[model samples]
Target: MDDRKTLVLTGASRGIGHATVKRFSEAGWRIITCSRHPFSDKCPWPAGEEDHIQLDLADPDGLGTAIADIRARLAANGGRLHALVNNAAISPKGEGGTRLNSIETPMHLWRAVFQVNFFAPIMLGRGLVKELKAARGSVVNVSSIAGGRVHPFAGTAYATSKAALAALTREMAADFGPLGIRVNAIAPGEIDTAILSPGTEALIDDIPLRRLGSPKEVAEAIFFLCSDASSYVNGAEIHVNGGQHV
Candidate 1:
């Protein structure tokens, strides 16, 4: 029953996930970050400690093993895991892009999108339920506004998967509430992340704010849900989309 707050962050190598890790670190929470690639040598964050683990969320075969390793780390550090952020996702690539009506949206692409967006988060949440229960922790699934809207830019698979994730958030919140575990989601609008491919200028213009969101802004919302500040907030979907979803 160590009193120190610990957070397990996925996709922490960059983007919103990276920003969240930095914020939590500054707030004095011990971080266990996961990424497919090793952090760059120039990574200024204090992730050099033994808590960082490299894991590929898209690799379904390795998901169980990765979760086990994370659980082991928590056990070794003292049975404490305050939060889990399921933020790892892959935007569709190539000529298909993420356009909803694109003829190029193949079954393989759809599968890939669901694999990382939907399956990974569900698997990670189920695997870490015990640790989350131990700390009465929350699970925050990073989703997109495209899930709720019919956006041509988001494509079919990406939007559909995110929509499913939103539903999953509600279900998890309901199921885990009695155990003192909270589940929530953040549906970001258009974040200025590298996830969006180049030549997508038109897509940026469609945003009502006329600009992309900063990763730190999204991170702040996530931090709120992770902390006691949002203790009463459960099964909630906070939109950080600059009024796009409104």
Candidate 2:
């Protein structure tokens, strides 16, 4: 029997998602990654092309097709999915990368944000429940510190979508627990990524750590939640912000 674990991760092209792909791949886990862009020839991961899926999670129709395609790919793993990480998200900004407040954010953009950040996770989870159950899988939703409180950089749409994702994580944990599946969330703060705004450096001094968090740090927390170390942990939202929440 092929006992190697498998993970289905979204948004694996960059930042925390990229770090996560490296972490799991190094651990000898088979990784299936989803992204809006096609697999790049320069991708460093092994079997990157074959294991990569081009998916636009915002389109419900496209997502449905992608789900089926993902299931087909999982057949080689005996229809087992050890982990599902809903890490793809979008944070739209105005000109000069300014925050888009509630009043100014367009309705289309707000809905688009929700579609990717909120709806996609649930849709993918529901679509892959069978595979998840087969492997007694863990699901990790990537949220943000902005979900709980206002942040200067994170826009209104992005913040609300993450908050919704956090809520959905708790609800999924309750519903999936009995099936031997775990669901959790990680709320990150001020991570050093391209997603950060131009003025992010100014806020670092206010952070308790007095520095920005690395993508690898967040990936480590995610690895823990998906691994046996967090077997009993469910419906929990772990904070990856270095005491910034305090």
Candidate 3:
């Protein structure tokens, strides 16, 4: 059996997810990725292309199959999963850069957002608790600043789902702590990603950092939470938002 650590990361094709794959891979950990899209050569990380699993988390259907496939892949390797990063998220918006607040956000859209941002993490974490325990692993959930406060650009469904995900991190930590598993979350502020709309640049001055955070910064925070350096940390959220919340 291989002695290297292993990570199962969602949304690994781009942005922070891609950076995280690079970070862990360079550290000699095996990475298994899940994304809505099929494996693309554009990513080209070590062993990442071959281990990609295509599944749309927002669909909220056939999660059982995803969990099974993930478990099977882990078993095929070393049967130990060191980290599960819930990085997949979806935030829908209308035309002209409008906000989909609580009242205007449709029920179907709300469900889809929650299914991807919140519920999917819950399912994946709990489903693989056994593997995590075997490895004394940690789970890092990707949250957002919108989760803790109202943001003009982020949709209500997206914000609330993240808040719920943060709460779930606490719950998972409390439940899994006895089993030697730690669960934490990182909430990113204004980051430069395809998800950020064109008009978002105007808000840059408000950030203490005076610039949008890079995906690499967020990935480094996630890496800390998954590493022995953060062994004493659990059920907490590290904000990588450059003092946006403060």
Judged by lDDT, which candidate is best?
A: 2
80-197, model 3: which lDDT tens digit per residue?
A: 8999999999999977878999999999999899899999999999899989999999999999999999998999999999999999999999999999999999999998987787
- What are the lDDT scores of the predictions, listed in order? 0.85, 0.94, 0.91
Cα distance off (Å), candidate 1, residue 24: 0.6
For residues 1-246, what per-residue lDDT tens digits would candidate 2 score against the true structure? Answer: 457899999999899999999999889998999999999876777888999999988899999999999999888889999999999999999998899999999999999999999999999999999999999999999999999999998999999999999999999999999999999999999899876788889988788999999999999999999999999999999999888889
Output the worst ten-in-a-row residue range by lDDT, candidate 2: 40-49
Estimate the TM-score of every prediction: 0.91, 0.98, 0.97
**Winner of 1 and 2 under TM-score:** 2
lDDT of 1 by residue, 34-134 (tens): 88888666455664457778888788878889999989888965666889999988767555453544466789888888999999998998898899998
Which whole-number lDDT from 0 to 100 does residue 113 have in model 3? 94
Whole-model lDDT, candidate 3? 0.91
Per-candidate RMSD, Å = 2.1, 0.9, 1.1
Q: Model 2: which residue pairs collide? A: none
TM-score rank order: 2, 3, 1
